[model samples]
Target: MHAPALALGALFSATAAIAHLACIAIGAPAYRVMGAGERMARAAQAGRLQPALVTLAVAAMLSAWAGYAVSGAGVVGPWPFTRPALVLITVLYLARGLAFALLKPLFPGNSATFWWISSGLCLLIGLVHLYGLLAAP
Candidate 1:
């Protein structure tokens, strides 16, 4: 059980690293080239990349659930901060999805603000997970 927790922690960390590389490294350059309108259109296009993004998002949610499970399994006692942080992270991700769905027009042109906001939310969520892993008893 402890090993699973540790492994899940490592999984979370690795996923975060990959996400940063994909979004910051590959995605940033791609966005700069395409511009926001094209980027939004590309995102809207049903293809390989969008499914991959959805998979990544689902994996992240599952990883968080695993961490919560591990914590509950007595490998780590309940940490005061972990649950709320996780909830906030979930909310941010949900909000991003909702923004994409409901506010599509807001995303398509010169919308660096959307990118920045989403990126910041992802970073905060990653940080919170790392903190939970480190602080877990």
Candidate 2:
């Protein structure tokens, strides 16, 4: 229940939710913004983006849940589940960051610079969440 944890979680979740929603609104065009190529965009336009966008939206909500949990809101649980969920969230983020950072093979269409920057940002986000969780009282 720390201020920094709450703030960071709120900020990250809000931005993530908004970004994912925007991507849903824009459909395939958003893929270009995400560093995906025209082919990927076309694929997304062909109806592949819906599922991914929805999943991302859910992930954003989960990030928000992490914020709430750390803020002592009692939104998801009693300790057993809450603590484990928080830990999972931290690991999830770290995994995402590393995969994006070192495993550029995930998005072949994306540019190296784009992957590096995005991955670095993801790593930073993960670290922030980790810090918030660890600092939680």
Candidate closest to the true structure, highest TM-score: 2
Among all windows of ten consecutive residues in candidate 2, which has the lowest summed lDDT? Answer: 69-78
Q: Write the per-residue lDDT of candidate 2 for residues 15-132, one digit (tens) a residue.
A: 6666666666677778678665566677778888554665476757755655654444343335556556666666776787788745676657776766766667666767876777
lDDT of 2: 0.64
Clashes of each: 0, 0
Look at candidate 1 and tell me the lDDT of residue 45. 50
* Candidate 1: residue 59 lDDT (0-100): 53
- In candidate 2, how many Å is residue 92 off? 1.6
List per-candidate RMSD values in Å: 11.2, 3.5
Q: List the residue pairs that clash in candidate 2.
A: none
Please report, in order, the local distance difference test score of every candidate based on alpha carbons: 0.50, 0.64
